[model samples]
Target: MAGEITETGELYSPYVGLVYTFNLIVGTGALTMPKAFAAAGWLVSLVLLVFLGFMSFVTTTFVVEAMAAANAQLRWRRLQNPKEEEDDDSSTASDSDVLQDNYGQAEKLPILSVQRRGSPNLFEITDRVEMGQMASMFFNKVGVNLFYFCIIIYLYGDLAIYAAAVPFSLMQVTCSAASNDSCLVEADSKYNDTDVCWGPVRRVDAYRLYLAVFTLLLGPFTFFDVQKTKYLQILTSLMRWVAFATMIVLALGRIGRGHGEGHPPLADLSGVRNLFGVCVYSFMCQHSLPSLLTPVASKRHLTRLVLLDYALVLTFYSLLSFTAIFCFRGDSLLDMYTLNFARCDVVGLAAVRLFLGLFPVFTISTNFPIIAVTLRNNWKALFHREGGTYPWAVDRVVFPAMALVPPVLVAFCTHDLESLVGITGAYAGTGIQYVIPAFLVYHCRRDTQLALGPGALNKHRSPFHHTFWVASVLLWALFCCFFVTANIVLSETQL
Candidate 1:
């Protein structure tokens, strides 16, 4: 059952692939965008969001191009070394004899005929070549290790964000009534862990308790191979659409009624750093391309499909954020935008309020175990030795334990989802989204030139195929890193 669940079979259509990509990219990050937009001002957020969306789409093509190149290389190597399978047995001929035989056969075949028929789809990005596998194939030892480290850090941040979001939502919803607080209450008012939730328990204590309960419930799944079933994905995706649509309609209605309160600045440079992180995080789908794209059939129009997907995603984000900024006062918007509509008076229904409040608990909780398992698998792959296997205890226990513990500890210390998303997206997220893709495409192009001659071309190469594009991506990544680092240092010094 587990094997079936975790199998990487190519059974999905391109449309399904698009939906998966959409869902994956539009996770917890979207929930934070409203706050980032409010802080940074609508115009700055709008420009940055569109630019980042296009940039992310560019990198997506880079990864797909790399996947195709990796596949072609794999096919070429197999064709060149056809005797590898038989070499294990003593009856096989020597390497020189095999090579001579292959050469003789190649001499008999026409070059164009071999190119046309020998491996017709050699460059098809159909195989499940994961990012890590591609890194191992294209990069040196140091690059491979760095790729793993960046991905691992991003996944850790993902886990910690998930760990904190659910319990925080639960604490908010459950404690709101007890504290006699309305959702419309000032957002700038900070809630402390020291504030009482029950008789003697503070809200922070309730938050910790909920985190403990959340860990106990979902943490065990990391110790085993757990695949999110298709049904769960469908349900969550459906719920996401419903929740987002509801908020947008409600906000638009409020704005139409002339109750809108937002009066944002043109551009706020102070907030650009965090907004950059939030936008980058919101558009992240590069790391999961293998899982999403491998199953996609009829990928001849994949680039177009991806472009359309990004168009829809960008439009959706704009609508969500614009409605948020216009409908509620900038100061009243919650970090999780859903909470803004969680009050009965605001949404005008007890059931809707409950549903909106518990939305994160359902959606984020469903993703936690899956992300944890992915992190665990990546960890195993990072230190994985060829032709070797781990003992059952280490395989089952240690990797998952390592994956689960640190993120939980981070969650224990802070529940600031904004800063968490910002730091994670700014640092590790930038590497995975921008830097790694640039390097991967560059190396893949160079490798293809060497292997297939200069005239050889990747059919799926990104439209931004110029050397300048790769250099631009790297330079932009460097700028973001320096900008974020300076911001962090300034923030620390101020504190």
Candidate 2:
């Protein structure tokens, strides 16, 4: 029971947990936000970002509450059926059996005949139950399938964006200024795909070449185990923070020097559609909350911790984005915001220019394998049969290929990182971040009340416990989908 896979992550202090959660929330999404901010204008982007951040926070509480409910359910089952015995053989499956199926027998803790003198809270989140396992416990078969479907779509989008971003960054840096002495720096000019990168090689061709290299380097890891080691995490986090600081300082310096090229409109509804997706993606730490929050030695102030982290992240995003929009024209902002500094005219130091240009490559390279392996494993779980092992080829070749192929092909056809991020966040992000959590908390609360007698209350229940909150989340998701879809249709018709 102690060595169970479900509880494998290392425990840490509450502050360390705070840092991990913050790092998780702010990643590639933050890097793309400046372009979104510029296009959407200052006031509209600010209002939407604040609203969405609050919504994301509400759902984060929902996930935490569900986790407590999941633990409470497990505890009740353990009390009711200690030895994994079936209470009713005639029934298709007992609740205890279902819990065991979702969270293996290794999770079956030995019940204490008498309660300890000072026991923990009734629904203390002691066990680290994953989102998928929680889904299996609380959702019907179809709901379970839908859960996996949304996650797969989200991961596919994530990989496609990554595939396009790294190669694009490499091309931008090498061709623009980092390695090319004769590189021309046009004021506020945005390059096209047909532009030459090196000699006769086109920018698009250079991107593809680098994409192949990235695939060859990281693709093999999907076929094998690639642990995200502690050292690797530390190195990547360090690089990310440093890069963010450098970009912010550079932008602020340019604005201070009165060399700002930006004169953005106060409002631009045409850009609102993409900005919605970008904001949603930027605040996406909900999916990973179980692993992120479970290890804290104390969760007494967990909600407060999450709120503080969100506030800090929101402020940081504003500084980074506002500085960028003021320092550079909207037309000049690249999909990956850091690439804007690659030109010698924008950033004087060659080393700083190269570092900013290649920042995505360095950080994204480390994350690509971890995400690929996770997607591959998710595929295996989705199709896994009870009491059966996969054939060698299916496990090794088919599953990995299924996980890796679609995204690569999408990246091949279009290197439009903004559209990739927008589409991914708009559809799949809404499902995972809003719709899923709403249903999860709603069902989980009912399951907990049924499992632990009618009187038993979840100690960690969300502050927004009223049924109204769940309904509101679903309604918001519907509105976002309608708005984004209508915007897309209108744009196509205008074109």
lDDT of 1 at 465: 95
Clash totals, every prediction = 1, 0
Can you tell me which runs of candidate 2 are displaced by over 4 Å? 1-8, 85-120, 178-189
Task: Please identify model 1 stretches exceeding 4 Å from their true place.
Answer: 1-10, 83-120, 181-190
Residue-by-residue lDDT tens digits, candidate 2, 3-36 = 2233435667778888999999999999889999
Model 1 per-residue lDDT tens digits across residues 375-396: 8877776776545678999988
List pairs with backbone clashes in candidate 2: none
TM-score of each: 0.89, 0.91
Q: Give the TM-score of candidate 1.
A: 0.89
Which pairs of residues collide in model 1? 193-204
Give the number of the best model, judged by TM-score.
2
CA RMSD of all predictions: 7.3, 5.1
